[model samples]
Target: MVLVGWGEQVFRAGLKGRGCGVDEGLRELAAPFVVPDPSGVAIRTRLKQLTAVDEEVLRRVGAHLGTLASGDLKARCHDGLAHDAEAWATRKRELTPLSSARWAGAITRATHEQWALARRCALAHLQSLQAGVHALRHRLSLPLGQKGSKRAPGGYRSRREWHAKARRLRVLEDRLARERAAWQAGRVHVVRGGKRLARMRHQLPAAQLTELQWRARWEAARWFLRADGESGKRYGNETIRIGPDGEVSIRLPAPLAGLANAPHGRYVLTGRVRFAHRGTEWADRVAVNRAIAYRIHHDPVRGRWYVTASWQTPASPAVPLAAALGHGVIGVDTNADHLATWRLDVHGNPTGNPRRFPYDLSGTTGHRDAQLRHALTRLLHWARTCGVRAIAVEDLDFTAEKTREKHGGRKQFRRLVSGLPTGRLRARLTSMADAMGLTVVAVDPAYTSKWGAQHWQKPLTSKNRRITRHDAASIAIGRRAQGHPLRRRTTPPRAHRSDVHGHRIVQAGGDAPGREGPRRRLPGPRTRSVPPDAERTRATRTPTTVRGVRGEQEWVPDSLLLTD
Candidate 1:
């Protein structure tokens, strides 16, 4: 979603207004000519002075008419009408009205206007048709590397766009020549002005002086034109400036000289939209990490101006950190759940996160990791103060990669990426480390996690394997862990698996493999048995009564501990 910003000034529609009203003027200029007058005064006129069409031809000479867009054609047509209308009127004044020449005069003048409009439009259409064919031929010349149907791979075109133009061009050219010759050769002049009409030339006002200026502006915007699909010519923001003052002063492009609104699909009748009280302006500059303006459009329903721009963000750069104890190599494993880090010392043996590993910020060690940048910033600052030397991080190639938002259910990957404090962490860490002359290394992250954090009392086997949770971390102490550690009993931490799960198994004995002995037992239950049947019988039999040396109380029961 793009936000509406400034530069709403580009949507004004009054520049074309400065130019003549092509159709309206043409109709007015034609009105007098098309009616008969009682007085006759042989009016003389020059061929070039009569119409917008003369200008149309001159413009079309430079215009790739066949390639001329509809907007361009409409513009040209507007110019033609305006000019032809005025010229037609001026020359018609040269002829005195006849008492009986009303209908004839109107028909003759109307015929002249139609003929001119048809010729210009048809010529543009024909040229476009031929150009289109040539272009298609070039495309078809390429090897059809693969084969299929009309819409197949590597095809020329699915449909031709300039067919009708060719027919119209041929038809109009034929008709114009025939009529011109008929009039020039003194075929007929039913009304008083009819003879002078043949000398008048017609041009549409849409493509006249003012309109040509707009076109020139469009041509100047090379790249912008390519990107925005040639959105017609702009008049240097004058339309907007003019509307506010209710007055306009502008240099006229020859094409706009006698311009007027065309009746059906007329030049001004089309892409020219008129709005009430809208502000428009040209953009001066665009900033970074901010939205870039796209375009301004006028909404008829809202009656309000809106602008749209989108923000393009940069990638998450890396940060390097190092400390004493020869810890330089850093391993980072990022996943959907958490980021695991291993800090390897001088000998390349990696240690796990410390109680104060500087990554943890809030909840568990994992929470600290989530706020990686924030935590890194603090830790890096602390490290700098403590005089750490070098910092290292894993380096994996990004190489033109893009993350695909999973099309399935809610993507766990996207959530994890969003929640990570990636960008800030990298920036702050890199800055702090570099300032302190701490070497920042982005090394391979491949198998750094294979070795457990520091040395494990037990092997990396299933029975002894530990997995860190989203809320826990394993903290590695020194070589001998110093003192007996006072047997500070507490909950054990979780494990890391992303790039750490190695293939080490633990043995049942206390010692790892070669140094182990048989399993030790604790006081529990008798699990041994004597000779089977005989022992069983002895245990089950009752003892016989025996005479013991008579002491006055010689009543000892024959149950001396129940010997088996």
Candidate 2:
């Protein structure tokens, strides 16, 4: 009888609705490739020791620019699909009187980016709706309680479920239609202060915030104090310039120019700033007057002001896969709470003990981000210690997996999938690894966990070293990245075993002498015997065959045999 383990059953169940094909319970896997280096870098620092006058000037400038930006965004949205270069120029000209030419340029650029982002988001939503509708229709078409294969989900389990799913299908269809219409019309829904924050306005008590605090946060979030860089300009920025000595100055709007503390209608803060991280790179860029964009924003909860400096870097040449795997790799399996990692050699063999770097993803967003960064820092340090030049990770995207329609009643599983931080982990790890002179290899995430458990889990586990499914998955990931098979090498067939077939495990190379010959005999007793010469004695005195011809043999038959 065939026995199925609980883990395997769970894995098979999870494959439902994954759009798997009929191919031996396997999904198409993408070839592994080295992830390219990040094309941009951003470093942030806080503005400290600001005077009351400085705060007043900053607030005034931010508020004035925020109004202009809001108006520009509104106009851009109104233009919709009909927007063009002439319309963009007209908007910038209108804002130039209220703000400076550079400020107008920044606002227009930001508005265009935000609008484009909204359009992309709308398209994604439409796609998601279409997927939901398709899945619901397929499942509803099947008979109730019908079993599903690994390739697709079956019908609902009961009449109640079927009815409920039928309602959901209609709702999804309606949503899909609306989203498709909006997409075709080039209309997108975007909120300036964020849709989540906008909704929090109705539940201030639930959010544990007073009306005044909410208003402050709202206005702070909407403020636009960003400026793009011009290579020929001072410090590579014209509007918001930070000198080599950390002196920050902003070109105030035309109306707010009267509040300028510095010459040329510019406002210079009493506070200075320094980026603790990537300070040398930032300084190098500033010294040479390379283009660097800057953004000033306020954190209402902390009541602190901060400035971010960002710049684009030239794209690095893609490293060949062979070169990246020369020094082996560290495969990392990202989870909701911790990272499961294993170091592997270039031959795709696990080199060291499996390591787990645990991080708490609870609390605020900043806390979660810090936790992730701290965990990754430890991982990178460990990788460097291992002398590996590449880190392998599954190219995971939980976008389709996180939907309620796809996962159904598995709320916990859905939450776990949604909380894996796949995108953030990839981005952070790629940027960090690039800085550390390491490459990241993203392998197909198709069946890492399942195949790892089946082929690697038990074999690698022992009393002293216990390998979890995630650790096994890390091994599989590393192997996959290195172009190795997931499953272990099969043993030789029974007909190819023992001395008759020469070797039991490995076959000799064709160039090997006597490659097809039987194994050489060893000088020892085959079993518990009288002496080591038993083979010679048996060969010399083992004539047990009786020689009898028909004429010479006596015809002696027993009486009992005759009677029978």
Candidate 3:
């Protein structure tokens, strides 16, 4: 997600709704491409069709899709199928298997798409192919759209986009090779990077298909990617699966959001699976439409597939989220120290508000990040148990890397959060929620903690703000160090709260002794959210007791209070 300035008025509005026309179109496209008695042709034969039977021109395109990247190859095929339902009926075409002309049209369509992409936007060209495949499955598998065709969208610029994409692609390639080498040895290096990027690496070992598809869809989305790092998002009840074998596929229909003019809210789902059948076991042809998506034939070396196509024509209405949205919302306050939280009921009242959970590690603070993480996880687990579906958190400033506090410890923390990486909490939360079928909503936590009740806010003045409060507000008149004998007066934030005989008392400062010299006033109260580059909130040592009043206690650890 791109981060605009805070004052830019970020509205969490959904994209314009559109009926799944593309999906329907794809499903319809696939309906005629399916072949019953498939004659699997060799990959070489498929390559020969595009090039002459001789070895010269065919070598230019390369034997596989991977080889086609460098050279300026034209995918000269049909932009789309050229068949009308009425015309087909008039021609008395059978509804069963794909005909020779139909197969030719498929190749034509592939060629046309490739050509279209080359001239305008390379990314869009790629995105369309993948989205076409995705939309096809959605429409075919489930009834997803009413008879409709929204304005077919175009792709974006592919030049600068490809450079950035290529960099990442190369990085992915290097990582994959290292992983493969490590994997073959039975044990792998403890990858100290992202689990999702890692898992994504494993799911798509070779970057060819995924890489091509990513660029393609980015082009399709008009160069806009879904916020929250999703190129395309799936909302309602959709479950994507990868077979045990290295077959890449997803069943659309339910939960696949942001589709061909598909409206917001929820959808029952609709779409069909499409893939190229490349093996000579089946005659070379583009196939589409059927329950499961066709993986077609794959190459062992390039890890590419051909003879596959995506089906469309799925349709469903958007529905309300019965469990995911309506139940309750869990608001997580991701902190630099710990994960503070407050659970709100349906009416937006704080029902189960818990003080900040202890997420600070003894030696290293970054490792304690897992505590906040685990706390969020526990909250999710609780939400799951409590039947609360959606979790809400503030949108974090994560697009750019920000400096962070160094968490110590040789092993406890390790690379858990070595150099701060302030964006970990929300990132992890969203990802975990995705796997658990939970919906996560991001809100603006602009002034939640800064603006509190009078009882919570009355302690920062020079005088004891709590005049009616008990003796806990006392300052032990102690002397400054050295021969300079002097009476010192100051109030200090102490550790260990006490409520003896209805009188509140606490130790001044924390675990260690007072300063070596006289003490200057400590920092002021820190704001809820830390400043991006600089520390925003000031720290203060004034003690606050809310036993009879708000009863909300500020739990600054004894550590920060300790004068080192």
**What Cα-based lDDT does every candidate model obtain?**
0.31, 0.83, 0.33
Per-prediction CA RMSD (Å) = 28.8, 12.4, 29.0
Task: Give the clash count for each candidate.
Answer: 63, 0, 70
Superposition error at 437 for model 2 (Å):
0.4
Better of 2 and 3 by lDDT: 2
Which portions of model 2 show Cα errors greater than 4 Å?
A: 1-25, 494-497, 501-564
Runs with alpha carbons beyond 4 Å of true place in candidate 3: 1-64, 72-326, 335-339, 352-377, 396-437, 452-564
Q: Tell me the tens digit of each residue's lDDT in model 2 across 1-564.
A: 322222223334443335343345455668998888999999999999999898888888888899999999999998899999999999999999999899999999999999999998887677678767877888898999998766567789999999999998988888888888888888889899899999999999999999999999999999889999989778999899999999999888888878887899988888889999999999999999999999999999998999999999998799999999999988887776778899999888898799999899778888989999999999999999989999998766545423577657877665555555667888999999999999999887767777888999999989998878888888888999999999989989777675564453356754466666455454354633344545555443435456422355667768746753
TM-score of each: 0.23, 0.86, 0.26
Q: For this target, which candidate reaches the highest lDDT against the unseen true structure?
A: 2
lDDT of 2 at 76: 95
After superposing all C-alphas onto the true structure, candidate 1 shows an RMSD in angstroms of: 28.8
TM-score of 3: 0.26
Per-residue error at 89 for model 1, in Å?
A: 49
Q: Write the per-residue lDDT of candidate 1 for residues 1-564, one digit (tens) a residue.
A: 221100010001001112112222211111001111112111111121213542343233223211222222333334443445565554334322310122123223444554565665455444434433433343344443434232111332222422343444465556556655643442322221232222221332433434444334333221110001112223222111111222212212233323433332112211122223212211211211122222222222323322232222243333212222344333333333234344444544434442133343336544554566554555455445544344444332221111221111225433333344443445545655544445444432221232222223233224544433211111121111111111223545444422235323333444445533454343244534433444556444434445433356656668974789
lDDT tens per residue, model 3, 460-528: 233533321111011000000011111222455444233333322233433335623334343356633
Clashes of 3: 70
The lowest-lDDT stretch of 10 consecutive residues in candidate 3 is 472-481
